[model samples]
Target: MVANDPITGQGANGAAKAAAVHLESILAHGDRPFDRDFQQAVADRVREGARPVVQWTSAMLEPAPEHLLGLLVAAAELPSAADRFANGFDAAADFGQWFPDPEGAADHLASLAPRG
Candidate 1:
């Protein structure tokens, strides 16, 4: 779990609560294209405007770690996706244990990459 404040170490709880509120606000507004301003608002609410506060769980690993590895490989291949997942992984590592085995995560993600 990661939070905006590394010193305070609120973990994901604060961010999760804020995200729920922001999601509710978005839903209340109905289906609409989220413009940059709206997107910024959501990001600000979640304390992700400057840096991301991600909360990884067993649920995210779902079914198996392979699923996440595949997703991470795909993300690593794209600039935008890389910014979110791959970069997020680096940021998560700064605060706490990002994964049980960083080497294993890298190997798993590598295995899922498309071979030439």
Candidate 2:
């Protein structure tokens, strides 16, 4: 499969790893992998589908909220519709907002932040 663009110059996998790592950091010692409550909440936030890691990063970056990794994990789990919304939001907002749906977000992110 063709590789996606590098988001933040980190490359696709790197971006994914970064997102995961960041989530781990945000989650901190309370739960190395994130608490079930947090995890479930994240799952709900995500639109509803599988998505690339960087796109997830983009979603988490929204609000530029602190301790973003765990939030990113949740964002990653967003639905296709929600991801798309966020991506479109970001593109229209000059990359300011998350995609409204996950698939759209993933596709949008792939276009903007492809792997090198």
Candidate 3:
């Protein structure tokens, strides 16, 4: 929020743009404004006399992906089949076998439920 002012000779023009960059990037989860770590990084950049890009993130508790990706990788996360498949067909060998969509787990659960 108004971290620098190049016009006023008080802050960096690029810093504002940088801030905007932080705001605009696409997000998954835990990548929003007022996030402790994210906020701290931006503030540190500003404090270091860096430029801002004027970006907006998805949520308050979330963090930037570039920063978060490392943490995710460190956690040894794996992509699911749903993530790999583009559509229903890539999931199975043929129609005879259930090519359950990786993302269709919830649907499978529903199907298994006893219907009246």
Best by lDDT: 1
Instruction: Give lDDT tens digits, candidate 3, residues 11-99.
Output: 34444545665654324325455667766676664444332112111111344344233323423433332332222222112211222
Give the distance in Å from residue 27's predicted Cα in candidate 3 to where it truly belongs. 4.1
User: Which TM-score value belongs to model 1?
Assistant: 0.31
Off by over 4 Å in 1: 1-9, 48-116
Candidate 2 TM-score to native: 0.20
By lDDT rank, best first, the candidates go 1, 2, 3
Q: Candidate 1's residue-wise lDDT over 1-104, tens digit each?
A: 22343432435545556667687869976877778988776766555522333334333434446545655566768564465454453354332232335664
List, residue by residue over 1-116, the lDDT tens digit for candidate 2: 22334444435444454455447646664635677876565554332212344464465446654334333454576464346445532233323343345454445555544368
Give residue 58's lDDT in candidate 3 (0 to 100): 18
Candidate 2 vs candidate 3: which has greater TM-score? 3
Which residue segments of model 2 deviate by more than 4 Å? 1-18, 25-34, 42-93, 96-116
Query: What range of 10 consecutive residues in model 1 has the weakest lDDT sum?
Result: 1-10
In model 1, the number of clashes is 0
Residue 86, candidate 1: alpha-carbon lDDT: 47
